[model samples]
Target chain A: MSDLASKSVTPGRDASASAATGYRPSRTLPIVAEIRRQASRRRTQLALGFMVLLPLIILVAFEFGGGNGDDDSNGGGAFSSLVDLATSGGLNFALFCLAVSAGFLLVVVFALFAGDTVASEASWGSLRYLLAIPVPRARLLAVKLVVALGYAFLALFLLAGTGLLVGTLRYGWHPLGSTIAAQIPPGQGVLRLLGILAYLAVILLVVAGLAFLLSVLTDAALGAVGGAVLLWILSSILDQITALGSIRNALPTHYSDAWMGLLSTPVQTEDLAKGAISAIIYAVIFWGVAFFRFTRKDITS
Target chain B: MYKRQLQIVVATSDQAFLTPAAPATYTVAIDGQLTLPTLVGTPIASPAAIYWYVLGALLAVVLLGLAVLLLVRRARRRRRVTAVNAELAETPLVVTGLRKAYKDGFVAVEEIGFTVERGQVVGLLGPNGAGKTTTLRVLMGLTTPTAGEIHVFGHRLVPGAQILSRVGALVEGPGFLPHLTGHQNLEAYWRATGRPWEDARFDEALEIAGLGSSVHRRTKNYSHGMRQRLAIAQAMLGLPELLVLDEPTDGLDPPQIAEMRRVLQRYATDGRAVLVSSHLLAEVEQTCTHAVVVNKGRIVASGPVGDIVGESPSVTIDVTDVPAATEILTGLGVRSVTPDGATGLIVDMNGTPRAELVASLVRAGVGVDRVVPRRRLEDAFLALVGDNSRGSGDR
Candidate 1:
């Protein structure tokens, strides 16, 4: 074997043997194919449907279960402030829905997309066939990652888009206002919403990264998704401890709600900046590890 | 003059967000437009945000740089591992010095090796837990071997090697996405290989599958035999140069099994090769041109089926008088003779030419109808593997 190591990979017969005539490793398992494969699954449809339906449910709750009771009394808290300004305009209601869901709902949705992609294939026993098809392991992971993130992004967009549409229709289109001395025109409000959504996407990157890593490590999709969400909950819990102090700032969930700063008059950049940076750093590390571990795995499943 | 006017306009706009208590710091009247400003030291953008953005960009660059460096290192290592040996260049498959020891101290295959050549239908004959599936798994790059080199058409086998694209395999059992129809699953698999559809030879493979209209039904609704046949068809996609199937006839009825045997024979007749594994010695004897008998994680015997069956020094003769034939055979210099049935005799030739026995029986009063080799592959297999034919526990 050691003597065999000095030889080149193929001696003139590479093009004529082994691979089929049209096979190309780079072209295998395109992202579109993976997206199509995942999109047809009932879970994906349910997930996207739930994203749209959640906002509608929230709107129905706001309309029928009306409680304008003591909005002013619950001041000084970020969530309470959003609640007080929920009906001020369509943009405010959309912002409120985002604020309520970004913490847990969006985290779970992102985890489901990233965490279930590879593990589901393994559970179905199709992974071995794909790997033996010689879909380069790195290319497979890359395609899955791209598709997973694409679906996650689509889910986020649907949630926010549906919220905006429902909120606008229910509460007439008006300028975004809050308890603070800030007023944004309807057009400007939509632009700010885009920026907030971008920040939310970045913040959820950490969840996607963790779930993707866990997906490669396990064959059980539920375990991978549940594990990622559980770890995030643990991080959020740790972030709640004041004694942890600056250590909490290093936690990925610490900046999960930092997009709230975008609702300010001049746009409070302090927390938003910290959140984006922290999210990027954590996402890079988790996703990098996932790729490394995946390419070398024996793929027994 | 335009620069100063622009500055005053920016100042006037900045005053709109200023706190009501803030003092008027700068006031100017330009082109009949009044400019108002409050708060002298407020910056247009937060310095901290700019700092974090730069830091984030730098960190991203560093991470990507590290990732690229790692990828290059892995690629170099992979190239080194995949270097072509070239010794068995024309052979479709060659495995040497193969060994696999699982994490729990279970040794599935302890130093086993074999090869499948072009135009040959070879059977890996073994009982349950004899490491047949394990060997196939390693050869297909589904699992890593502890120590070995598998060369497919001269190139060393590695996980996701481009060389593997020429090899089609079904190890263990058929694995399909339950929600997809059989046709869709096969199409999806072929598409994932990134080969052109025209090269798949779908019609030929489907003809071999014989599924007909069932091909359109979801795989979840398929029975075990249907799934097995579909998996075999999937392995035949692109009419690959080498086909490796494990227990290909596991759940098939007798007719389906016969159909598969004919399919494999035809597949090998076209200058390609097939390596099939099964515990049924009779199936191997009927379907394969060559057999590699393995038991307890070791090769016990291997060669053409006839060669193995011929190793037994015995022949069965259909005769007009079994008692007379047996008595006459015993009188000759043979090892033993026994009556098999009403008109048959089993005789151990004991280094005697089969023609000699027939010549002697014809000269005597005994009438010989037919003479066939009594030693089937089953006998040779049992003799080669002996009493320890049962597996040593598969990993």
Candidate 2:
């Protein structure tokens, strides 16, 4: 404590020094603190619960439908639908899981994790107090963005890791031969799977940033999450319309499925590269907007 | 389906393998529904043009980011300059010609300036739309000033300014997350400050809030009064040097209000200053040592509560024989004599002294039970704020 930390109503001696010395607030909210605040909430648990249950539900559905192996689409599983890839080894099945979930379910998961982070605080009327707690306005949003993205990436990892574990146990860990590059070593195979997982994580950062930006714009947590999901759905719809020309590429959903290129014989690297670069560019833009708007916002809530 | 298209290509390829010299001109139809824009004449877009478009978009976003960064930097620079230039000596707060014109062009506060020194319990009194809340908002750095300046703890008050650590504020009303327990809300709030939890006088604040075991329960179950107390406790964390409360007693019962009054008095005892805004005039009069009266975005009167409510000509007299006193007072040529009831009357003594009225009453054998000045805070506030400055209130 400083000498000026007195109870007298009059300004303390060396008042400026006392005031300056006493209140050196940290620039960021601790990751642990943020996790505590987020983990205790119902939405976080609900999202996790849904994520854990998804693999089991898909497993049941596949068990009921696995008898239909008489279909002729078997060899095309690498570049084709997940339904064709189901009977493959654990690696292919997990990849199939990522393929299916990356469309909307994982988008919802990203929206829930990152999108609900900041806006929920604002909706609950805690944002004003956080800023008033002497957390610099920019720092408040920055801390939230970090924690939100952290959770988002963690959720993706968990989903994929869970699928990997369950698929390995249910099936056998055979080499992913067709798409695994001709006669590749076992270590390289694991590396390729990790590489694809990493690629997906990077591209999904665009959604994380988008949801976070929406979180800053709207006070309602559900609105932010739903709005991001809506935009993703809109992008997917637009992507389907070949008439959109290159304009559909501007939509956030455009590059979402670009990870499929990793399954090609020679590994079509162009689409994967474009997707990663575009995602990074879009993510940077979204986060930029978030920081700018949040710092200047009136925060009436 | 693309699969059907591929199957035709495959069958033709198999036949070509069987007959090496066979000539085949296969008609293959690709999926037409693509966004790449190459199926028809006058193609405006293509997959080849995508990289350029993405680059152009990235450039636009980068430029926007730069612009916003420059603006934020300029604001920060200006705040630093103001803080350095400020001379906030011997006062916890000082406002010099502060003005705030909201984006909607509502001049909520205009050139309203005052100093809150130590050991002062200053009441900010105003009617609806008189700008009391706006003034506090500006002072707390929650809103920016348009053309004036504010210094708290001898540093410029601006958004993200660190001097805010020395001051605690509960503006408008108590806002808390209902899902969190009162204690949890306070805990989260303190942690958000980035200050160590040890610096938080949690026990002291809890005692002040008087939530007791309810502090452990969620604030969602709290009554309006409990919420207010919790807010007060949140503001009191670390026992900040300056406390700015808006309508602190608004939701409190009489007993709670009384306890809050004592808490405020004790808060200011050790040289800490408090600025409280209240609509309740009697409460302000009873609780505050000094007052600043505002009306229509301007300060009308400010000084000690006693000075603002100084002796007025009107006096409420309680007497044993009201009619007899009224008759005598009417004959004595008082300005106006309105009978309050059977026991007393309110007399507007137009320059007549209370001593003279008492002597006259005694001469006439009317027993005067009590005599008190009618200098009420309500009257003082209404008089200071004026008659026509009411209504069209802003929310």
Candidate 3:
């Protein structure tokens, strides 16, 4: 002990030589890590995998049930009825698929994605460590938004791609013929497709926004995701009430039908434009509220 | 030989000696008449130029606002008197009668108040559920106190970017993205904190963490010690004025724990104040100069580490003749002599020095033996915590 003490007292030793370096306390890296983590989860992978297989299954069912010629003279048969349904610029098979995907499945997926983004960190007891680095709440929310949007878009794009592939193989990619007394030439069909994809992107953002808001309000990912989806379902049910028609326009899921306008021969731009505007407004408002609440909320629990 | 030695002394003395030089002063006299430099070629004042000036003025106002925010945050740093003086000009991080209770009204922490000096490493030592974590959360603005005010750096704890920029922390387990490599996790953390991407200090932090080439590996693969190191690394990233760590070395091996101690020591040397909470008594004893011990959500003891671990006077006498030595020590006013197995006797000298005891023992015809001071902080800490069953035989 005496020898050790003497050695410590020896002069000329540089005390700071072994100082640790590269300390960075921030949330950006953790958010990115979270994104990668969520992507690899069994449930997420399963959801994405099933989404990829859905269109093929639907197309096969359509083919086995006999082709478009099965329609009766009154357009009452399954295939012709599907065509007739498309004519209303609202309830066609294409619109049906889109509505189900966006209004229900997509909302759920987005809720799961955005809702679980931060809440998962909290549940795993990692939120304290992430916040400990002096990360401002705003920047943390921003990264979460980006990751959620990325996943939402990826899901939408994959669904759209699958739909196109199946539709082309079964009906042939001649043109996206409209039910609303419009004939889109095959040459301009791709443009309409692009417009449809863009519309879906906007619609998905609304879902993502709602999920993000729920995520910020709660620490349980399941609660946040379920809450957003429940809200979506409730809003959709409310939209069905004829007396609340005007108010229904404000519901985030109301814009799910906006892509139907893209199928018109002359391409009806009115409702599509309105829907886009509504989606943008909803996105901004939801994100603003989420950010404000996140910044102010005490994360003690 | 005498002449040569005299010559050497004269030369050495000449090299060492010097005469004091006169103080130099410079005086300048300014003319009373005011003079302006000639205007350069009729200053052009176009309407567009006026708009530009307006824009510039607006920009300057925005810039000034940003600078004020930065200054306020800097001043909020715990011990940094410069920023505190510039802003509050007095109190920095004032937590007056702070209290926090869980939803069930179970008090987790209550009435805690302490001031941290700039660049000092203060240890918060306590058993599990002692409210150290709760106290840190309140300080970081993560959890609101049930009662009382908390002023960080100098700004009142608010949900603002400026205040967070000047502080850093590592609470509980290292919350990191499992899929991300340690480096990526840190990068993401930096970006989310509103820090610039090109922060050079990040590299230094990584190096300090001893992660080396392993920083690029996913955190899921990192050992507990490595993760702890990574957490410490991430906390030190921005040279933040205030750093808070909770149970930083809970799972670390001895070497890693030592490394963490060293890293924290370096952080304090930079004039950055750190508050680290830990259950490991030995780690706190080695690293902390000041400490606050919390028990059941209340501060039981606090102050300098030396003071909290109260000094006790005892001497261990190792001699060939133990029986004789014990008898001799008892005669020297040593009230108690505890046997340390078969080899040594722990004589309670009761503030008496070894020399005096030795002389007395020698006068009594007892063979002289080696005497050593005994003051293990571990022993004192156990006593302080009221755990008498912590010694070698008992435990």
User: In lDDT terms, which candidate is top?
Assistant: 1
| Ten residues in sequence with the least summed lDDT for candidate 2 chain A | A1-10
Complex DockQ per candidate: 0.31, 0.26, 0.08
lDDT per residue for candidate 1 within A1-301, as digits (tens), equals: 0111122123234534556677877899977788778877889999999989988898888788577864554857667878877877788888888888888999999999999999999988899899899887878988998999999999989988988998999887987776553678899999989999999999899999999999999999999899999999999999999999899989999988877677777777788888888888788788889888987777777
- Candidate 2 per-residue lDDT, tens place, B1-395, comes to 01112222334436646765777586666678434445553543546456546656776877887689768776865557444433665577888898878888878887798889988999988877778887877766667778887787667777777778788889877777677899998997777666767878787888878888999999889998899998998998877878999999978899988888888987876668999998667878888999988777888788999987777788888888888889999998999988765787888899899999999998999999889887755556545644445532344
Ranking by lDDT: 1, 2, 3
Q: By descending TM-score, how would the candidates be arranged?
A: 1, 2, 3
Which TM-score value belongs to model 2? Answer: 0.80
Assess the local accuracy of residue A194 in candidate 2 as a C-alpha lDDT between 0 and 100. Answer: 79
Q: What is the C-alpha RMSD of each candidate to the true structure, in Å?
A: 10.1, 8.7, 31.1
Q: Candidate 2: lDDT of B196?
A: 64
Over the true interface, candidate 2 deviates by an RMSD, in Å, of 5.8
On a 0 to 100 scale, what is the lDDT of residue B256 in model 1? Answer: 94
> Candidate 3: where is the Cα deviation over 4 Å?
A1-100, A124-133, A150-175, A179-182, A185-206, A230-289, B1-96, B149-156, B159-161, B194-203, B312-395
- The CAPRI category of model 3 is incorrect
Prediction 1 TM-score vs. true: 0.82
